[model samples]
Target: MTMTMTMTRSLTGAMAAELTSLRDRVLDAAVVCVDRGGLGRISLEDVAAQASVARATIYRHFPGGRDQLIREAVDREVGRFWRDLAVSVRHLDGIEARLVAGLVEARARLEGHALLQRLLRQEPGDIVSVLAESGPAVYEVLATYLEDLLSIERLRDGVDRREAAEYLARLVVSHISVPGGWDLGDEPAVRRLVRRQFLAGVIDGIEPDR
Candidate 1:
């Protein structure tokens, strides 16, 4: 009886893994469809065709349909952004550098992400809806990260690290919301401007002497 139970559990785990793989394929197909033709042009049938899976299969993985799938895609992309930002933070020593690098890297990344570009330009309404509804989750993650980063970096004596971090995060996200929002032309330019304006300004403006 114990052997039978163990076998059943193993089989269940394997099936779960396989299902996850299939779901990822469907999501990838949806991204490809959106990349090629934009969200308005993508459909359940289009996703199924792109994924080479049955329409029912796609629906089974994402029962909420098109909106839910799109949201999932956006969340996945946002997760990647956060993860990459975290990695980048580890390599830098100063709070200001980390803050600027994170946003500048985000801008470069947002430019290449297909769904993000579409949201920035073509479907601003939907993008706004997502941000309004989903913003708190993003803020929570960012706040936790900033707290840790500030403590470790020991940012300058005068810096209101919390407000500065908040401002920079929001600024980066705002840039993502609008296509061609930052005219920096390159990452270094973005890094320079954000460091000078957002980071330095926050620290300078907060000093008691000022």
Candidate 2:
């Protein structure tokens, strides 16, 4: 009985891992196809051939067909971006350091994402439509994430954790969209901006722990 249970657990784990692998392959292929051509132009056959998987397997995993595959692929890539952003700032203890790290990381990821840029350039309307639906949720998620990090921060007397977090989130979103004068990828400039203007409004002063 013990052996049976142990074997059952092992098989379950292996199956789950295999499923994840299969999903990743298909999503990667879908992303590449979409990158090469726009979403409207990419077909299920293109994804299948690129992924080296049968169309039946893709349908089994993504029953909604090509639409589902593309949506999930985009979501996965966006999730990966946020995860990387979180990791980039996790070690920093101070608000200033955290802000600088986050801004730099976010910009770097944005600049590096080829498919994201291609979609934005070639299919602006589609990207805008998707952002219209997902932007608010993303804002909330970033605000919550910032709230936890900034709770211990020494903010201005009138400022609270929630307010500070939301403020930073708004700034981040704006800066990423239209970083006209400031350079987010420059660590020194970002740190300077955070110290001089960015946090000047929220906190009287913050010397992020070195």
Candidate 3:
């Protein structure tokens, strides 16, 4: 290739790598901000400082500004959540077991998440939009697992697995959004209750029990 073409290819590769690193840094910074002060108080300066980048760098990656960055951060976290859940549910047998396990895992993970716990404890309502947008993705993951379990007749015959998964996903999302005052004393108990209640609902919906 010509000298100009070679230089152009080299610059393009460098730019791509830098952009990827910048995106990862931005996401990490967002997690730190939410952990430290919740979403409402997460300043762009704080994110930049946490990421060790100039404030302008954040704008370059996410041009919609702070709100946009926050949304991206939330979306990234949600994506991680779904990936984790998918892995956890693999190889589990019964629909009810998978359902309960998934719900419990999701609740514990989300509620116990350092950043999310801080946000829920402090700002409370600020993360709702992000959480809401992520709900459908969670629902799909749950549905796939439920279908696997139900197909094997491990769950009740008439269960609307899709609806059930969506309901539990919403329930968990809503529960975490509420400000529980950081009295994590009830976290374990609440998780147990959620598991029990969710499993019971599924069992009851199966057949003669409903």
Candidate 4:
């Protein structure tokens, strides 16, 4: 019985690994399809063909079909997007500079991303809804990054790191989603604006006593 259990466990582990590999391949193929033909243009058949997998296999992995696959692909892409942003701001001096530079860089990158452009142009409602629904997830990602970059002493009383992170994330997303006549194209102007609007609360040496 012990030997049988060990064999079964090993088999399960191998199967799980294979499934993960297959899922990643499918997601990679889906990303390529999105890049080439945009979100609305591709079908499950297109993804299957791109991944060199059968339709049944796609269904087995992604039972929710096209929508599920698309959501997962977008999630993966968003993670990559933030990781790139993190790297861009990693070398900047101080939390303030990092936040300012990171926000500006994120806005510029998001605006210029081909996938986002296609979605905004071709399927505005769908993209908007997706972004709205994913807001919390985005906040979590940004907040985690901020928590790492920021010192506890810098935050104001009653404002935890998560709250501060969420505040910054919301501020950035709001600016990106709706333009308010500010010249976001100008880096210096953006930095100043960010400092005045969002960073004012979290600036160093402004912490209140507990």
What TM-score fits each model? 0.73, 0.83, 0.65, 0.82
Ranking by lDDT: 2, 4, 1, 3
Deviation (Å) of 160 in candidate 2: 2.9
lDDT (0 to 1) per candidate: 0.72, 0.81, 0.68, 0.79
Off by over 4 Å in 1: 1-9, 155-168, 175-210
lDDT of 1 by residue, 115-135 (tens): 666666897776768657668
The CA-based lDDT of model 2 is what? Answer: 0.81
Give the clash count for each candidate. 0, 0, 0, 0
lDDT of 4 by residue, 81-132 (tens): 8788889988987767776687677778877887788888988887777667
Stretches of candidate 3 exceeding 4 Å from the true structure: 1-18, 148-210
- Model 1: weakest 10-residue lDDT segment is 201-210
In model 4, the runs with Cα more than 4 Å from the true position are 1-17, 156-160, 204-210
Could you arrange the candidates by TM-score from highest to lowest? 2, 4, 1, 3
